[model samples]
Target: MCLKRGRTLLQYAISPAVWLGVWQLASMAVGMDLLLPSPMAVAASLWKLAGTPQFWLSALFTLGRVCQGVLGGVALGSALALLTHFTVWGERIFAPAIRVMRATPVVSFILLVYLWVDRATIPAVVAGLMVLPILWGNLTVGLESVDRQLLELARAYRFGRWKTLRLIYLPSLRTHFASGLLNAFGLAWKSGVAAEVICPPALAIGSRIQQAKVALETPELFAWTLVIVALSLGLEGILRRVVHPREERGQ
Candidate 1:
């Protein structure tokens, strides 16, 4: 059984290995690490980064900003969604604004925000703005999707608004909220870090990445990118476990 499990794991790993091989070959063909680094080089750079206190500090700083932005966005988006539901005029007023935000280029927002705030806070605000529309839109749709018949039944049973919201609206909205969070979290991470790279906060992963780029440290740049991807994936995994534990238990 141990051997079989090991073999299964190896089988699962093969595809990634093959893809990495192709990437390394392409990088070698280009003969410029400045453009594209090999997997081994990135791994080595990552190992070096893992040994540094500064690396940890920078990573933590970025992580805190991302978490703060996500939490703030979720709260504001949920509140806005509820308000829009309560008043048709609110919906009409907010919908076009959300659409405009969604349509605006992220770079434009970053530049605009940079002019107003310092580097450290710009990432958080940019992340929040980027995620707000996604959460609001998805949650609004989720609330709308709640069964009208079930709502009528709740009313017939004399369920208060709060009780109905807790028992009925919440369960129905979970999946939509989950999807929104998953999408927004990744987007927020990328855009937030991009903002940071441009703004160069005192101690941020993006600042380090920007330095790496300026110094032509391709391996370190790739390593930082790998770290970002790892963190994003880790957060997503934790959210999945916490948000859908019942689904796992059922399985």
Candidate 2:
């Protein structure tokens, strides 16, 4: 077991060493920090940024926007899913519209949405738009996947709608709902931030990233990109821990 662990560690270290070697070689070949900043340069800029209050402020504000967008998307998507699941007419009403939403380009929606809403709200709208179809589609499948036998049993036992939903429907749907939320949350954050970058919302990480890009601060740009990646990964890790702790612990 110890031998296996040592081999795994060595293998992991080998990849980074190889990548760093390639990156350094490429930097030397280019001989221009403006084109592609070295890994060390990016790291140094990230370190400097980490010492600033604005870094935390921007990160927190971006997180708040992402959170708001996520909640709005989840709530709206779940409601729509339930509506379509319960009513044939509701399914007919929304099925085509949902398809259109899914097929439409993100940029098109962003541009159209910019007409009335502020830059701050644009991120939320974009996030909601991206997440809506994903959650709705997954949740519709989940609702339909409820066992007929169990539902019939509930009916036989005179279960009320609330009781039936809580006991039979919810438990059965948990996996699908959780999966949808997990998948959509990441996409929402990415699209929301992209929207914010385009819209140039004040105090947002996206705006900071845009500013870095405009100033040709490649290291700062890379640092901001790294921060986004880290935040996304961290949020995903937290969600996994909270929502699927049993499965992870078992593993």
Candidate 3:
């Protein structure tokens, strides 16, 4: 078991190094920094960005947008799922809405929402819209799969509605809820960033990325890309740790 774990750790360490080596080679082959900045140049640019207040502010706001969208998606989607799960009218109403969201292009939603909301909030709105369908479907399935017998037992025991929900419904829905959370954050992050890129928020990683492209600051662009990747990975890692700390430690 120790040997297996050591091997896994070794692979994790070496894999990124190998990719970096390939990236360096590609950059060297390109021969023009403007076209493809070397890994070293990008690293330097990344260090430069870290010194700027704007960089931190952009990161903070971008993270806030993604988190806001994700939270909204979870709450709204769960409510819709419950409504649809328990009622014919809700099913009739929400089924078409979910289908529309699923079928519609993200860019269309972004553009339509742009007309309705300020540019600053578009990223969050787009992010929430993208994640809503997934959570709604997951929660609907979860609510459907919940054991009626457990609910009956809760009633027999004179469990209050809140207690029944906390003890029975939530426990039954955890797997599906966890599934939604695992995927929703990434979707929210991607959609949020895309919205920012299109709309160019005052403070955002996506705005920085677009600015870099416009100025042809290749190294800065690469550095910003790296930062975004790091942020995404960090958030996902933190969530995984929080959700499955025991499993992670055991492994």
The lDDT values for all models are 0.91, 0.89, 0.90
Candidate 1 structure quality by residue, lDDT tens digits, 1-251? 99999999999999989999899999999988889988988999999999999999999999999888888889988888888987999889998898899899999999999999877999999999988999999999999899999999999999998999999999999999988988898899999899999998998999999999999999999999999999988988888888778876796
RMSD of candidate 2 to the true fold? 1.8
**Among these predicted structures, which one has the highest TM-score?**
1
lDDT of 2 by residue, 119-181 (tens): 888888888888889999988999999999999999999999999989998998889888988
Tell me the spans in candidate 3 whose CA falls farther than 4 Å from its real position: 1-9, 155-161
TM-score attained by model 2: 0.93
Q: In each prediction, how many residue pairs overlap at the backbone (N, C-alpha, C within less than 3 A)?
A: 0, 0, 0
Q: Scored by Cα lDDT, where does model 3 land? A: 0.90
lDDT for each residue of candidate 3 in 1-251, tens digit (9 for 90 to 100): 99999999998999889999999999999999999889999999999999999999999999999899888888889889888877999999997889799788889988999999999999999998888898998888888888989988988999997898899888888889877888888878988998999999999999999999999999999998888899999999999887668777996
Where in model 1 is the C-alpha error above 4 Å? Answer: 1-4, 249-251
Error of 1 at 6 (Å): 2.5
